[model samples]
Target: MATSAVPSDNLPTYKLVVVGDGGVGKSALTIQFFQKIFVPDYDPTIEDSYLKHTEIDGQWAILDVLDTAGQEEFSAMREQYMRTGDGFLIVFSVTDKASFEHVDRFHQLILRVKDRG
Candidate 1:
């Protein structure tokens, strides 16, 4: 009798956050990564979570992805989300100047919320 060689159940899990200004393709990018589908339209996101299994260099890992709303009004809850993520993907459309400007702010906020210098 041969036991299974894959230890999928033992793989580590990571919490990832995708953040950017509104309409900056944050959701589309996340969905594409998890489902292999590209969404052509834009819809505002409040908050969304996704799970996906990925393998890299013969190692398996599970990802818990969080998609965040880009609107400034949701800024109040940003700290809470920041605290939960192990990593973040900050996105901004090359054509959108306003969105580009806010990237630094988001990065700063994440550091502050996570209490990292």
Candidate 2:
């Protein structure tokens, strides 16, 4: 019997959540990372997920990334997703002062939701 180069089972999964103010490029960043393309359009994202299998530090793993809405209207959904995230990426547009300033709020919210102080 031939052995497969990459195992199909028992791969660890890392759940990453991206958050930031609207138009701060959260979706753009996520798309670029997963799809290797730049999306200049600014369509609001409620929530989007992408999955990939790759090697990490010589071990196979799965990357499950969640791109979340930056609009205040979707704030209620933040905590729900944050609770399951193993890591987070707080995005902000340097050109937008307000979005840059709101990074702390997003960080604090994540800390609060994850009970990580």
Candidate 3:
């Protein structure tokens, strides 16, 4: 039997940014995905980041997920992080209509900052 070794340093990193309105379960979704736990309480996040080594499409890669603050006060920092993200997960709470409606805003922001438009 033979084993092939993959170079650790050469592994591609995918940066995913989670964005949404406050209390929209952005942190909860991020924490659950990274830590495998459900947090019922809502704690406003300024910013949080998680890194993991995982296999994607049968190839190993580094997953860098940024959990961002959804508060208006943190809006200033949105562009800073958005500029660094390769992709984004726009989260919204099903129970909160406002959060759902603002999804377009977040999407637009990401596009504007990323210059994807």
The 0-to-1 C-alpha lDDT of every candidate, in the order given, reads 0.87, 0.91, 0.90
lDDT of 1 by residue, 1-117 (tens): 433355668788889988889999999999898789999998899999998776645666888999999898998878888998999999999989988999998899889888852
For residues 1-117, what per-residue lDDT tens digits would candidate 3 score against the true structure? 343555588899999999999999989998899889999998899999999887877787899999999999999999999999999999988899999999999888888988952
lDDT (Cα, 0-100) at 36 in candidate 2: 97
* Model 1 weakest 10-residue run by lDDT: 1-10
What C-alpha RMSD separates each model from the true structure? 3.7, 3.5, 2.8
C-alpha-based local distance difference test score of model 3: 0.90
Question: At residue 91, what lDDT does model 2 achieve?
Answer: 94
Q: Residue 35 CA error for candidate 2 (Å)?
A: 1.0
Which ten residues in a row are the worst by lDDT in model 2? 1-10
Alpha carbon RMSD to native, model 2 = 3.5
Q: Candidate 2 lDDT (Cα, whole model)?
A: 0.91
Query: Which ten contiguous residues of candidate 3 have the minimum total lDDT?
Result: 1-10
Local accuracy of candidate 2 as per-residue lDDT tens digits, 1-117: 443477788999999999999999999999999889999999999999999987777788999999999899998999998999999999999999999899999899888888952
